[model samples]
Target: MTGHDDWVPFEITPGNTGAEATARGLTAYLQGLDDLAGLLTRKKALVFRDFGVTPEELDVVMDELLPNRLAYVHGNSPRTKVGKNVYTSTEYPQEFTISMHNEMSYAYAWPSRLLFFCQQQPGTGGATPVVDGVRWLAALDPEVREAFKDGVRYTQNLHGGMGLGKSWQDTFETQDRAEVESFLATTGSTWEWKADGGLRVHQDRQATIKHPVTGDEVWFNQADQWHPAGLGDETAKALAQIMPAEDLPQNVTFADGTPIPAEYAVQIRDRGLDSAVDVDWRTGDLMLIDNVAVGHGRRPFTGARRILVAMCD
Candidate 1:
């Protein structure tokens, strides 16, 4: 994409696909297309609109999009698993906007693509905005970009069943501690199990990543979302007053553990949103995004809305 104005996703409707309004039609159209991954990397995002894909046909449509669907394991967002590998998109309050960040960018491994299916439309707003990671990085102030060159450190304090944020069980999607440890071992992360049945984990990762196929270096960390400043004044102050930085449910800092300035976090969050293209949802709409190339977030809305999300490697 050249810039924000030219960075909108490539939309495929009935006109482009020459298909009927059915899931089987979508699958056939996709099955005939060559190098879908190449197209996704070039377009960054894809919209399959007016397909009228029913929930019963979701799995087939998703299989055509890409296979090896992944569970939302180790995900930090507030969500509910409603299917084998599908989840109700971020359950953050409808009145509040969620900042842009790649799905699971804070972790050691992340999905290559994310598919969102809108099961119900909201009364107003609730658009899923996507930001081109390259453009997002380019829009940031040079000083801010330079400061994050070395990447950042992330900390998570997951409780057993009670306390702040997400519980270890929900975070890992398993009751077996051995499974959790086995997963963590592959991430090169350090973790501690507290006497109170809490899990504290620390991981350091780079601020940017290069796409495997396109070889494009893009902004790829969740620093702003993990930092206190990004949590808004009231929440940040309340958390700080209650415990030290390391004790928070989630926290981030410079790779060296130095605090990231509130202003930096603001610039990062605001710039990403500013450069985003909002994809308004309609019932039965489906969207697929190349997770590394584009980061996504939600716009505030009203009334009932349900978007199911699934990802693939």
Candidate 2:
């Protein structure tokens, strides 16, 4: 085990233990577990390297690790669904770093556990950086933390089956409006069908939340990721020029509707990264994250990289 603050995950590798033996050991460890929740509460992340675990092998492992595989409903990022409730990691450009963020923090409910499988390692520099959410919260400026105390309101303008941004059908993974409405209703989110064949949705989420087991307050929202202000000045200005902020695919403001300052947004994004430790990838590497206790992101890379992702409650 590594240091707690800038922690590297506990790892198992073929070098120390044979690949087949590791798989058998891991299976036995999980099967004997009386409290998977309690284990994750203490160690927020775990990495398996050089295990030579292929896609078929992953299925066997996932059956034990993530029994209830979750679908990516109401997910914002662009990804291809590869298997039953499994998807490729974010399809962002390879040269750009995807800033640190908890998976689906803007949504009403998020996966408690995230499993990432590195099928193909990049030629250079494609580390999955992860940060302790509690550390990220404590690293922010006092004023910035205080400013976000009231929480944040998120807005999404998903198109209806077509056009720019995500279509409502794609976002919800269903063509039925009633199903989508019912799902949102359970979350206490408000929505309206726009006359232009679009759906406008609003959700207010908190910046901090307590861990269910540990009861430690951690930075938990995706305000900076969804806010236009978090985009650099040039890009933000261009976006503002093209459309009103509210009409953007997604945007965020204070729960009371006050705009968050661009500086604050940048600070939040930067500090999270600054406090992170990178988990360098190897072919057949697998990483599991406790979503509430840590946030994960990607570093810029060259050449090919393929990572498969699956989430479970």
Candidate 3:
């Protein structure tokens, strides 16, 4: 029930149950321990104003509150920042939308949490939208769920670099065939080389993975996002011709060799969009999100806008 003039924390309606505010300073506010648990339990996100906390204080708060976790740093800082040249194809340079999926969904490892801090708000557009992955998965038909439970597959071109500006080779630090093969093996994926010298890998992972904390089977992968590789260009091109974009399910395949059912894709797309909520950014507002239950992306913006992010475990 206690509050301060400089700090105004309130919950956004609907999807989010947490509190947020733009405050004058962060050190005292962050150090107060009484409300920390409640804030975390109820409101998974907290937005605050920049209060000129020194690097030492910032590190203390981040360490105490977030523990050992990766923070997606952006812009120039004494610490770390995402390089300016990095681009993301999964979303785009334009206002196109990205599908809902956990970060690093194609990889064997994924971050447990994520934090996005907005240093500047765009003149227009570029809303950060998020969806509840668990709820979205729970609403699926039992039969459809079963089909996915059989396994979910993803096909990713190891060379395109998606939007991260760095190709898989660059990210992984080696193009050696043995190293690539070893990486794929750890991900439990199957892959092949393209005639053009690209590598395509497929991962037929379980649609539902037991949550490490809750021990509940949560839906994890979306089928339409991936495809199979290794087929000759002629055959691959032929299949591409015969199939619809969603129907081809090129990335991952079933044990029986079927693509993900189109109906399921439609369902996921509709539900994901329906469940999504957007966070409008204000300068100095920092937002933390539970990546397991929520997926997030940015809206296109014009003018000078800056945001910093750190993915937390």
Candidate 4:
């Protein structure tokens, strides 16, 4: 991976791709691709700026770039599905920054690529900051990395139809218990249905994984995001006082069932954000990221922001 200071998306524009670029936009860019996957694998990320990509034309561009876009099923984040396999980016308060993580890294399966389109840019600061996974891994303290060497266990306590946190129906995108059970079976998760009509799930996953092509080890778990420690102190304390950590909507622990220290979680979260390179948004701009190689998050902004995201295998 390249140095964070020097990292920038490989940009292509109408001016560089010639007259046909104006007519075809991203399709023209796709035509020039000898190997789209290879290019993304090498660069990790690419930006298409000033291509005049409109929402109406986004499907064509998506077809060319991500031929097999996958549905956002079993996704934990709160997002409204906008179209086939596409959704608005996490609708967190514009004042709070979303920390970095590889999409669905906590799951047994994950997307190979993630694409983002900026339909509307925010007034102040809504940049989608991205960090090279390998770089982020290296940026952490050696002790912190060693502590997570074994792996991490993720736990989710989803409610039935209505309760705290995400409902089981929303998490699985299906109301059928049999269907949810079938899906969980495939993921190798241990689950139990509660008397109160809730569900508890547990899955152990590696904290680090090697990139398929590069063979570089990168931090690969969403431990920080899942652990209460990553929440601000006030919120974490308040939640802890209300419910046991194991009963929280989401939580994480060491693979051996040891607790991960709050300071360690904070360090991981802060370092990932500190090491990221922010991609400032512009309306009509699009970004494609090799998900295994890069982790992305949103920065706080003032006015409205509309960024759509889709993922592919």
Best by lDDT: 1
Candidates ranked, most accurate by TM-score first: 1, 4, 2, 3
Q: What lDDT tens digits, residue by residue, belong to model 4 across residues 216-291?
A: 7888889989988787899899999999999999999999899999998999999999989999988888999999
Candidate 4: deviation at residue 76, Å?
1.1
Put the candidates in lDDT order, highest first: 1, 4, 2, 3
- Segments of candidate 2 deviating more than 4 angstroms: 1-4, 14-29, 32-35
Total residue pair clashes for candidate 3: 19
Candidate 4 lDDT score relative to the true structure = 0.89
In model 1, what are the clashing residue pairs, if there are any? none
Summarize candidate 2's per-residue lDDT along 199-288 as a digit string, tens digits.
Answer: 999999999999888877789988888877666778789999999989999999999999899889999999999989999998877898
Q: How close is candidate 3 to the true structure, as a TM-score?
A: 0.67
lDDT tens per residue, model 1, 1-313: 4554468999999887789778878888899998899899899999999988888889899998868899898899889999889999999989999999999999999999999999998999999999998899888999999999998999999999999899999999999999999999999899999999999999999999998887878899999999999978898898889999999999999999999999999899999999999999998889999999999999999989889999999
TM-score (all chains, Cα) for each model: 0.98, 0.94, 0.67, 0.97
Which wins on TM-score, candidate 1 or candidate 3? 1
RMSD of 4: 1.4
**If both were scored by lDDT, which would come out higher, candidate 2 or candidate 4?**
4
lDDT of each: 0.92, 0.87, 0.52, 0.89
